[model samples]
Structures are given as C-alpha cells and as structure tokens.
Target chain A: MTTNSISIGIVTYRTSLEYLKRCLRSISFQSALDSVGSVVIRDNDNGFDREIIEQAIAASGLDKSLVKVVEGDNIGFGAAQNELMKLSFEKGESAHLCLNPDAALHPNSIENVLEFASSKKFLGIFEMEQFPVPHPKIVDPYTFETPWCSGCSLLIPSGVYEATKGFDESFWLYCEDVDLSWRVKAEGMHCYLVKNAQVAHFVHSRSNDSKEDQLRALPLISAAKHLADKWGSPRFSKDMAKEYERRSGISIDSDSLNNVPRPSPSSLLKAQPDFSHMLVFSPSTWIEE
Target chain B: MRPNITVVTRTQPGRESFLETALFSLSSQLLVPEEVLVVAHVVSSGPFVELENLIGAYKTQFNSIQLLTHSFEGDGRTVSLNMGLEKATGKYLAFLDDDDVFYEHHFSSLVQALEKNDNAWAFSNVVRAGYGPDGNGYSLRERSQPFKRSGYSFLDHLYENFIPIHSFILDRDKCPSEARFNENLVRHEDYEFLLRLASKFPPYYLDETTAEYRIRLDGSNSVLDGSSGMTSEEFMLKREIWVKSNYILDQVRKEIVGWWAPELREVTEKLGRVADYLSTTDLTKRMEEQKKAQAMVDEIWSSTSWRITAPIRIAGSIAKRSPIPKKPKVHSLKDGHEVVNEIKSSFAWKITAPLRRVKDAKLKKQP
Candidate 1:
C-alpha cells in the first residue's frame, strides 16, 4: 500500500448500537475506503456487544478482511485509541483516524483530508466539521488553520502520532484532545481545520438521573484538576470548581487534587508557545453550511 | 413593652390620594407606629405645594405624621428609603408603598413574630388587589397564603420573592446596614434586598395576612407590573437576568450551611475534582515557564564565561558521541529451532498454505 493510505480506529464501550451502526454505514460509503489500509475496533467492554457490532459490519457488506475487532477490558477512550494506533502502525499504515463511536463522517471527508494532509510538511491535526454547531475552535476558513480541535474526529499522521506519544493517558475523557494538541504545537507542529471534511458527532445526552450525574461528575472533575495542575494555574481549577458548586449546589474538595501528578518546571520550561496566538482566524470566522 | 416602630412610606407625584389612604390605614392600626415618615417626590413645586396642604389636613387627625419631599427626576425609592432609615429613631422599622395598605394588625403581628424568633426581620402573608384583564377592579384577587407557614427557608426564598416589601418588619438594631435596598438595581430591588437579608439572617414568617399589595394595572405605581408592554417570554427573561445579575444563586449557595450543606459540599468536592482534571491553566503556566527558560538559556550563552568554556563544551560533545563496542547476540540452537517450529505450526501458516502455493506458481509462470 502507498504511504498515503489511511487506517480508521474506533473505541467502543457501552455505546448505543444504533449510533454504531450508522457510524459503520458512513464508513462503508467513504470515497477513501479504496485507499483504507485497515479498520481496527477495540471493544473496551470485553466483547459485550461484539455480536451486534459484527452483525452491523456484515450488514454494511464491506469486505470482512478489511475489519479487525479486538476485545479487552475498559482501558478508556484515549488508551484504546493508542492501542488501535499501535495496531495500525504495525500494519504499516501511514495515517490513523481516531473516531468516536457516535460520530459519522461525510462521504468525501477522509479523501479530502488525506489530499490536504499530503501537502503539509509536519504532521497535520485535521479538525472535524461538527454538525448542528461547529466545535468552537476558531479556524481560518481559507488556510484551514486552527488553535485546537476536538478528538471526536481527528486525522493524525503516524509520524505525528509517534512523536507526541498519542494522547496523555492522564485524561480518561474530556480535554485529552487539548492536551494532545498543545503537545503537538510544543514539538513545532501546526494543527489544521479541514473545512470541507465533516463528521456529524452524535453527542451523548447527559442522564438526568442523580446517580448517573454523580458518575459523570467524577471523571470531568478529575480531568479538569489534572489539566490545571499540569499547565500551572490553580485559579482556573478553583474558578471551575466554584462555578460547578454554584450550579450544582456541590462543594468541590480541592484537597483531593493534590494526588494528581504535576508537570515538572523543567518540562514546562522546554516550550513557551502562547496558546491564544495559536489561532490564525478571529473568533467570528466559521464555516458556512 | 411596646416596641416603637417607624413606618417609612415613599410616594410618587400623582399618588397623593393613595398616600392619604395608606396613612389612614396606619392610623387605624391596633398598635400604632411612633411616626409615619412620608418621603414624597414631586416633579414641580405645584405637586409639592398640594402634598403639603394635604398633609396639613391629616396633621390634626394624626400628630405622628412627618413629610419629606424631593424634586422627582426618576425612580429613587431606594435612595428615599435610605434617607428615611437615617431619620428613623424607632426600635422597629417597616416599609409601606404609597399605593399599598396594611391591615389594622400589620405592625402588631410582625412585631410579635420578630420578638418570638431570633431572626432580624419578620414577614406576614399579603393579599393582592388589582384590576383584572376585563378592566374591572378585583379586590383580594390573590393571597400569599403559601408563605404564611414557610417559616424561614433561604433556599425557597432564592427561587422566589414571596415576602412583599410592605408585609415585612425589620428590627433596626438587628438588621445590618448592608441589608438595605440595592440602589444599583433598576427593578426587583425589594427581592434583591430580601435575598441579602436572608443570606445573613433568614426572616421569620407570621401565619397572618396583614398587608394588601395594590397592583395598579395602569403600570404607574408597581415596578413589576405585567402590563408594561413586555411579552411573557421577555418578562421571564428579564426576571432571570435580574436574579442572576444580583447574584441570588451565589447568596443562596453561601447560606446552604444547614442539614443539606454537607451534601452540597460533597457535590462541590466531586465537581472540584472534575474542574481540576479538566483545567488547561497548567498548560498556560508551562508556556510561561518555557519563556523564562529560553531567556535563561539565552543569558547563559551570551555570558563571557560561556565563551571561555566553548572549547571544553566541544570536547564534552565529542565525548558524548564516542562509539561503544556492540554486544554480540548469543542464540542457542534449541531456542532457534523452537521459534522456527512454532511459526511453521501456527494457524496462520496452515491456513494460507494454499494461497502461498498458488501465488508461487503464478510468479513462476510470469517469469
């Protein structure tokens, strides 16, 4: 296969089956499927819904040899993507696409991104065309340059993936993409927004049930604390904690954040890129339709 | 001992008849106030002259009446109230809108409730009278009976403004000066003031209706008049903005120090964990650190001492790159045979044997 060939990676936990089916159907019709080297799926639920996923794939009528399913314990979103990336790299794939189970790509998304990515010298972090409202990453419409992009749908060159060591495993859910993007920039690489490459991410609706609310709160708080400490601002963490407490009537225990590993000052001293200046486009700039 | 009470009433230019009626209601109170301080605003000297003449007529009937007038420019009820409060020498304080009236037992009922409770203020239920949608006057259209037995719940008060301004009485000494009306707010000043009071000292509730809230549908006297050309959505949106801008939620959250406080604190702790985990401020600080480090490196390189160590640094670099002897790999014959046998016996080799033979034959034919 040529160096421009792409591999798609999807990590599934207890995701909705209907959403997964639609995601697979979108992938089956992609124009770049002919150039797709492999499709690897890591089931974080240890083959809990493997049958249903396999049935969806079979119904899509894509070549069975093109897909590979690996069952394992729930390592988390970032870690599972890392596993898929490793598998794709071992298969000699040049680029890796990290996809959320609930996201579906537009037909020409993969093809368009690859075409644009081939011309760039550094590893390109392609942005997703989020449906309904675009992810609030300011992007230069003409140049496709952005400060940061969501990992819901990202196209990462293998070279860049290896250089940044994938995402920081510290983040189990939210803000992992931001950490990865910053690290990529620190390595003197630019992340881009592919204006035409659209991926409709079906955001998971938050459960109103109080138990589920508590369950969801834990990871988000953990991630926020890790980011604040790693980046060096206790104020951001305190403000966010205060806002959450005001909205939810819950006091945040800041003392628990002491356990999170902080980035050494020496490591921080290596790169001093201004995050605000990373965006090439003004806040008002956005994609039409 | 009877607590001396000062009833401060603010009236607009054209509300002389309503102000007279309000003063009459105070005169009929079972426990009369020590003084009825009327802060009336007039646009021109004509209205002020007319109000002085009207008060002159009431002075013969009630000797405790006092009138203070100002040139009216805008809604300055909060400013007038603060001025009235400064002149108030009574042990207890009460407020009366010129358009609203109190029942005969309003002062007595509130004082009794405040005396029984340790709270700074006390409020009674209020009956609302207004012009109905049909243009006909509706007397006692609604009563604030629900709040009569509400006791003192700061949480409930956060979500609503149940205590009408005129229905409440404050113990002047117990009430903090900061608990006065917030002059900054153009609307819902009463609710904002009550929220501030509730945050520090939750007001006691008397299970009695001792006041009437007169809602002039003509939109002249009432600030919360629904007839002010605002759509229901607009009204609600404005109300929400007022509540948020006044930090009502923040005040209520701060006062959540009772039974539910621990639960809230637990929730806050969990949320704090989430905030800490998701914060990107550390990344911002790292960028700063990086700049400082770069500056230090630049400084060190430009120093004369660094120039003197150039030859030593070059020798160190050469020493760092010096080649080391490679270690020889030792392989056992038994281990090599075992690896070859395992690969040959693997399922993948067995399954692809036919395809491998066909590919080999095809390649031979092509040559």
Candidate 2:
C-alpha cells in the first residue's frame, strides 16, 4: 500500500441505479485512476441492487478486482460508513473518501484532493467542492479557517480517521458531521475545504419541494437535542426546542432525551471560533452565471 | 354612578397665563371635575395674592376652586403633590402641570377608558408642543412614525417612562395609599411613581392625543428642560444614577414578589448579579480596551519579529503532523485478480452464469 493510494467508500440505501452508475463512472475517469486502489460499497439493506451495482461496475471499466460489495441490515448512514472505513483501513489504504450515494464526483476531484492532502501532510479532513451553491460552512478565504464542513463528500486521511475514531455512532442520523468536525478540531487537527475537488450533490433538489416536510424534522430535532446536551449550553438546547416547536407547530418530546450522555466539561469549555469575519452573503459570480 | 374626579394642578409663581389655559380647558370639560385643587408654590406675598385673586375670578365658572399655597423649595412639585393628594376628595385623581393643558375631552376619555376596561388607571397620548431649533416659536414636535403608545409591559416600562404623568387618571380606590411620589427623585419622580403603580396594575391606554405638553424655551424648571451647561460625562453620570435607581426600585418590586416563591428569589438574585456586572463594566471602557488589544495584535502581525519567525511558524505547523501509521500488508492486485478469477470459475458463479448472461440476450432482444 502506497501513501498516495486512495480507498473510496460509498454507502447506499434505495439509491437510483443511474445515479450510482454516474458516480462509479466519475470515479473511473478520475485523473489519478491508479491512486484509487480500492472501492468498497456497503449496502445497508438486503442486496436488492447487488446485480445493478455489479453491472455498473462492469460498465465503469475500472479494475474488477478493486470493487467489492458487502450487504447488511439497515443499521444507519454513519454506522454503515464506519464499516466501510474499517474495511479500507484493513486494506492498508492511506486515505478514505466517504462519498454519498446521491452525489457524483468531478473528473479531477480525487486527484486534486489527494494532491492537497499530501501537501498538508494528510492530517486533517478535506471537504470536496459542492456544485451550484457551496455549502454554508463559511471559511475565511485568506486564513482557511472554517466553523465546520459538511460530511457530504469529506476526504479523511487514514491517520486522522484512526486518531479521531471516525463519527460518533450515537448520532443516528443528523448532526453527526458537526459532532465529528468538532471532535477533530478539539484534537488540534484542522479541517479545510478543497475548492478544486468538486462533487455535484443532488440533495439540493430534495430541499426544493414546496410543501413542509414535518416528518423529516423528527430526526433533525432529536439530533440537535443530542448535540446540545453533549457539547452545547442547556439554554441553546431549550431555545432550539422552542424554535422548532414554533416553526413546525409540533412539540418535541424532550423527556425522551434525558438518557443522552452529557459532554465532558472540558469540551464544553472550549473557546468558540470567531465568526465575526464570516461572509454570509453569496458572491456575485454565484448569481450571475 | 358617576365618580367624582379631582383635577390636581401643581403650580409655581409667574406662570399665570399657562395656568389660566389649563384651568380654562378644565372648565370647558363635558364631564366636569368635583374641584380643581390648585397647589401653588408661593414664595412671596405678591404671588399668593395673585393666585388667590385668580382663583377667586374662576370660582363662579367652576364648581369649586381651592388654592393651597406652599413655600417654594427644591422639588416643589413632588412635595406639593403629596400635600394636594391629602386634600383630594374625588373618587378619581388626575394631575396637571401648570404649564401644560388638557383637551376638552381629556378627563372624560380617560374616565370612560378606565371604566370600560375595569382598569385602575388610564393614560392618553400627548401633543408635545415645543420651540423649534431656532427657539423662535412653538411647534408640534415631529414624533416618530410608529409612536410607542402606553402598554401593559412592566419590562418596557422599566426601560422607559412612556406614560406621561399628565396623561394619567388614577382610580383613587385602586391606588395604594403608600404609593406616592419619591421626593428624593428630583427628575424621574413621576416615572418612579408610575412604575410602582404599574407593578400592581398596568395602565389602560386611551390612544388619543388629548393633552398638550408645553416645552418652554427659557429653560424653565420643567421635566422636558434640556440640561444647559452639563458636560457629556456629567450628563451620562446623571443618567446612570437614574438608571441605577430605577433598577433598584425594580429589584425591590421583584423581591416583594420573590417572597412567595424560592425559585423567583433565586432568579431575582441572579438578575441582581447580572445588573451588578453590567454597571461595574462600563461599555465604552471595555470597547477601548478591546480596541487597544486589537491594535496590539495588528502591530504584532505587521512587525518584523512576526515576519522573521514566519519560517519557524511554518516549520512548527509542519512538525505538528503525526506520522502516518504503517499500513498492514493486504492482498495485492494480482492476488485480488486471482480471487476474482476463482469466483468466476466456481460452481456458484457457473450456476449464476446463465443469469449473468442475460445482458447479451436482452441487448439482442432490444435490437
């Protein structure tokens, strides 16, 4: 296993075959093709798309030996990704790319991220470029200091992943990314946004629906309460519950969250990053073109 | 039954014309008062004679005109008000400054509002007439578009005195007898009294411009009189004193309520701590300190020392990276291909070979 080799991990559940094929095709066409030594797909349900994924892999024209699919019961997103990372580490891979099922990478995304990772000594998490509008995890353009980066297409080096122990599995669904990012930063490791390594994420289309999706808020509110309990001020949790109740017109059962573990006092007392210089507005180029 | 209303007007000497206007407005009220108790501060015999003569002339038009004289002293209004409050015999009480006048329906509107809402007190909007910047003549002050009228918020009331004293009409029975003007407060006595009154019952708002607050140009001893010679620091100190006093009185109100509940007492203690913290740290001083610290940071960032140590800082960052752990020896590409070749040759793969062969058949069928 070479230091520059990358292992790609994808977690799929009821994902469209065409989108999966496009994702595989994009990876096959990456600029540094030989650097991607392994591709692991962990299916979080019964292998319904096993044949389809095999057909897509055959169509992608990559090394058939490098591709492997493992099936399991519906654990969760973070849990499934953890399984893939464990597999990648056992394979002696130096870097792991946690790619979302609904996203397709740009042609040079892998090459660009690997280049940047090598220059930085491959110690921090590097988020890939998001198309259309960038993720709202604002960073100072000059300092490269960000509050947190999204988990949609994060590239984690083997060393940092092993050190931070990946995502906290307690967060079943949402805010797991924030928890991971904060934990990584707490260890004095930095995270950066790799602007040139782009991924075209299709999740934005899911948000454009006109109707209010109240059901989706249940897990989100639960995750937020869990986060606030662990590492945030109690007032913040109370305010979040109140605001969600007001906006969604559905009361959250906060009594259920009593069992969540509180964060260590040291983590709670960590100094917050200064966001006074954050640029909240979109640049003119985002709107013009 | 119609309640008797007492019009308590506290006057000082030499404002005869303004007093007459106030009195005339009262005399023309559709709902007349039981008596106009004129608490006059007469420092000399001449002013007393003038006031007595003036009341005597209006005694015919009014049902009763009583003139109670007091010696001129510091903060004569609060002192005379407490004295006049004793002489008031009406079921309802309303105050009027000698320099301000009420509209014809001022007392009637307030009475109706208080009666309709079953409120202990009612207050209306005022048309603030003051000299323009040139000090030439009086004109209506240009109020903000959304004028904040009287409301029933104790927190808002604590921050500001939105209800003018003249605009209020109190139900004498509902007002606690102990709730009187704080003679110590030369400046916000009326505001302080209203705060105490509001703690018991929020004033009902009669949203009508039914009174005129006269602002004199000659720097008279009125609440609206601007401080003439006070420096900014002196003015700020005066404001801080008033704010501190208001906060103390507010805390007292909270403490009285806190006696019933332990939680409330705890909350009040916390609030007191917060207030103490706020008062001890002057915002401007803190801002200046922050500015100085920021300047120091900027100076350091631009200094030659920072520039010279840039490589060392870069080296420090480079040295912080932990060495990557040794990778475990795993199946190489040739070994992986051998496993794939084995799977292709196995019985299960051969059994599933027919299923996998459907792609060519499906393509042939499509053509």
Candidate 3:
C-alpha cells in the first residue's frame, strides 16, 4: 500500500441515492485518486441502500475490489464512521477520511488537503473547506489552526486516529468531532484547516415537521449534555438540560450527566474546553458576537 | 394528461448561468411541473441562441418546454410575466426568476395546500440566501428570513409586500380576468396583481420554506450588485422599488374593511378618554402657572405695602418668625370646569400620560 495513501470512509443513513451517486462520481474524477488506497461505506439503514450504492460504485470508476459496502443497523454517525475507519485502517492505509454522504469533493480537494496535512505531523485532524456554505469557524491565518474541524470532510492520519482512540461513541450524533479535536488539543496537537480544499455540501433542508425536529434535538441536546459534563462548563450544561427538558419533556438530573465520560483532570486543564460559544469553542473571527 | 402545474420562468437574454440552476431546481422537484415556459426579454435582434441551447438540454426532463421571446415598449418584468401567463395551459401557474431555486418539496407542498383549500393561490415560505463567489460556483454568505408571515392578510398586503414573488402558486380558473399584472407598474407588478386577486379570493399559506431567493453578492444578480458583500446598489434598488411601489399602490382600488367599524367604535371611545386626559395635562403650562403664583407672592412680600401689612400678617400667623411662609401654593392652576385636572399633578400626571401613550401606541400598532 502507498505510505501517504488515504482510506476514505462514508456513512449514509436515509441519504438521497442521487446525492450518493453524485458524491462517488466526484471522487472518481479526483486528480489524486492514486493516493486513495481503500474506500469503505457503512450503510446505517440496515443495508437498504447497499445494492444501489454498490451499483453506483461499479459505475464510479473506482476499483471494484478496493471499494466495499458494509451493512450497519442504524448506528449513529460517529459510531458508523468509527466502524468504517477501523475496516480501512486494517487495510493498512496511512490516513483516514470521514466524508459526509451529501458532500462531493472538488477535483483537487483530496490532493490539497493531503499536501497541507503532509507538511505538519502534529496535525490531529484536517478538513477541506465546504463550498457554497463554508463552516464559519475561525481559522488562524498564520497557523491555519481552527477551534475544531468539521466531520463533513474530515481527514486525519491513521496514527492520530489510533492515538485519539477515534471518536467517543457516546456522542452518537453531533459534537463527537469537537470532543475528538479537544482531546487531540489536550495531547498538544493542532487541528488544522485547508482553505484550498473545497467540498460541496448543501443538504440543509428546512423541515417544518416538529417530530423530525424533536428527533434531531434529542441527539444534539444529549451530545451537549455530554460536552458540558466532560468539559466542566456549568452554563452549557444548564442550558442544554433546560432545552432538553423543554423539547423532550424529559428532565435530566445532574446525576445522569456524571455518567457521561470525562477526560482526566490534567487533560481537562490542557484541553481548555470553551463552553462560551454554542458550536465553535475557541474565540473565532469568522463568528461575530 | 398534463401535470396541471406550469412554471413560468422570467429571465433576461444573458442569464444562462443562473437560469441553469433555476431549471435544475425545478427539474429536481419531487412534484415536477410538466409545463415550463421560459419567457426571455429580448431586443429586436431576435432569439437568444445560447438560452435556447440551454433550454434544449433540459427538454427531456420537463414534459413540455417552450422558449418564448417577449419584446415590450416599457421597462418592467410585467411583459415577460404576462406573456408566460397567457401562454400557460396549466390549471395552476407559478413564477420562477432566473436567480432563485425551489426546494424538492416546493411544488408538492404548495400544490397540496392549494388542493386542500378553496383559495385562488397558495404560498410557501421562502428563505433568502446571501451568495458570494467562491473558487467553486458560489458561497452562501448567510441565510435570513427578511419576509416571514404567519398567514395571508389582504389588509397587511395593502401595506407592504411580505411575500416574495416566487414563493407563490396561483390557480388559473379561480383567478378573474381583472387579476392581470399592471403593466404600468415598473416594479411590484406581482404585488399589484396579488392585491387584486387576494381581495377577490384570499390565498392559503404553507408554513414550510420551499424555495431559496438567492441574492448573489458576486454582482451576478441585478437585484443586488453584491460586490464586496451586499452593496449600496441593493439599498439603491430598494429605494427605487419603494418609489415605484407608491405608484403601483395608487393604481389599485383598496377596500376599506367595512366590518371593523364596530370594533373601531369601541376604539374611538377609548381614544376620547385619552384626548380628555391630554388636553388638561399641559405639563409646561402648569409648571409656568405655579412659578407665576410664587413670583406674585414674592412681589407682594417685597413691596412697601406688604412691609406695612407685615404686622397684620404676623398677628394672623400662628408661627410668625418670618413674614413669608416656606412654600406658596398655586391656586390659579386649579380649573374648576375641568375635573380631570383636579387630581394633584404629582402622582396622576406621571402615571396617566405614560398609560395613555402606551394605549395610543397599541392603537397605532393594531394593523
């Protein structure tokens, strides 16, 4: 296997098949496909879309043996990514990329992100900038270090993935990447962003369904509770508890939050988790007060 | 059978790039419109070959696609819109600008809304996106809801346009012949038509944002000369639109809601009390009157006659250490005819006016 090669992992749950086909088509057109050693897709909808995805892969111009689809039983995004990453890492690929199913890569996106990450061994996680709606999290121009990298097009070396022990599956849905990045930061590693790399991700559908919103809110608020408990931020914890109760009508006691996993006290001190802002932790120029 | 939905897209001759996205959005619709009429504004030079070629590529996606060329004497979007509507054979009609996009469920949701209701038209919520050029096609700067309404109100419609033109789908049979766009209107022709149509048949409102109104900050869009962000050209265009809107508003005969008179009668009675409270409580006038009374007493005390009468005042005074009392009361400020003013100025004066101001402000915001 190539030393600097990447093993791309994509997780899909009730994703548009058209969007999936488009995503694979974009990857097949990559200028640096030589750097991609393996590709694994985890279908979190119990292999419902596996046949369609397989057909898409067959047409995608990627090697039939190199790309494989695995069935998943609706496991959460972070957990699904972890499973896919493990499979690819076992294949001896040097780097891991957790790409969103909705995202389509630019021709040079993989080449640019890999080049940027190659020069920096201390990089815990690096990601391509999303096009049309780039993440507004601030990046230091001099250092190219952001508060955290988005899991939308996350790229990290397999060694860093092992050192971080991958994402804490307790996160289940959102903010797992943030927890991972903070943990990486605690170990004195930087999470960098590549502006030259661009991925097209436009799946922000505004659903008027209150039930669907509530379903989304549960995982989000649960993750928030975990983040607040682990980071020792009373404000974020209190706010999430209040919101979770308001939305779900289920009160979460302080005792329940203690069950959430926490970093060591020294790791907590080093990570310096900022619960000041909602999504992006450190002070960022991109987001205005 | 025809799909019964006609998407009347109004575009300029040179807008092939933006028109592609607009067409792509329509093509991607869950309930795709079978009929698409692309009405382009053209000069005497005839058809836009590039636009025709672009439409040719998407002909297989749509059921029946027609590229219509319209040449009008005056400058306005009404010409293209009117031609599209006239040529439209669908029972339902909709308008899509070259720059905007419909969500997958946009057509399906609004169609459902219209199907359920007896309304002449139905509108779904539309979000506005601020777009700037990235290395890729375009980067969305931000999304904001500049126009969000709970429901449709004909009275509120008379005041200002809260609905974007593309957010709505209108029924052809339910609409009267008089509900045509006012060609005299250089802008807000849709608003003018909506005013007339809504007066006759109140529309239904779908509470889902099914379309995106893109304001290209890259200056590609004429609506916003979005160079270096949302520029002065946007404000300038709005200024021009409002000025034109004034003319459009005057052209239509607005109905005076006759049923609200009974409620207005109660409002008038409350206003009378507010007027009665305001007339008596002239604050500066009362302060002046008090000052004048104090000065008169001071004048009398400083006079030689007052000095001569000091002995009588001292004899009359219970505490006669000084010729003058500590404070003089103003009797002249008391108006016997006005009972409202009889209440002492300190407590009633402060609380009453503020309450009335709140009352009047509430009344002003009623519409």
TM-score of A-chain in each prediction? 0.83, 0.85, 0.89
Tens-digit lDDT track for model 2 on B1-367?
A: 4338988898876767567657755654546687789998776655466677767766754567798888756447678887778888788999998877676567777888888887888887765553222223222222211224434556556544667778889998888876678776656677778877787787787666667666643334353234444577865776676686666665655654544444654555466445544654767764554455445444534444344445555565578774432212222222233343343333233333334335434753582
Question: For model 3 chain B, where is the 10-residue window of minimal lDDT?
Answer: B337-346
Query: Which residue segments of model 3 deviate by more than 4 Å?
Result: A1-41, A45-68, A89-146, A152-165, A183-216, A232-235, A242-272, A279-289, B1-76, B82-93, B98-104, B118-120, B128-146, B171-180, B214-245, B254-367
Off by over 4 Å in 2: A1-3, A206-208, A212-218, A243-250, A255-261, A269-289, B1-367
Q: How well does candidate 2 score on lDDT at residue A231?
A: 68
Which candidate, 2 or 3, has the higher lDDT? 3
Give per-residue CA lDDT, model 1, range A1-289, as digits (tens).
1248778999988776656775776687676788788878889999997987897688555688988899999887888898898888888888889988777666667888887787675365876666423554455545766766678889888898888888877677876777677667677677887766767663322122556655556666656655665666676667656655755677766744455455456545543323332222123232221
Q: Which CAPRI tier for candidate 1?
A: incorrect
> What is the C-alpha local distance difference test score of candidate 2?
0.65
TM-scores, all candidates, are 0.40, 0.41, 0.60
Task: Give the top-scoring candidate (DockQ).
Answer: 3
lDDT (tens digit, per residue) of candidate 1 on B123-235:
87776553222122221222223334335555546554678789888897898765566666646677777777777787787766677776543344554444355676876
* Structural RMSD, model 2: 34.3
Q: Look at candidate 3 and give me any clashing residue pairs.
A: A132-B140, B217-B226
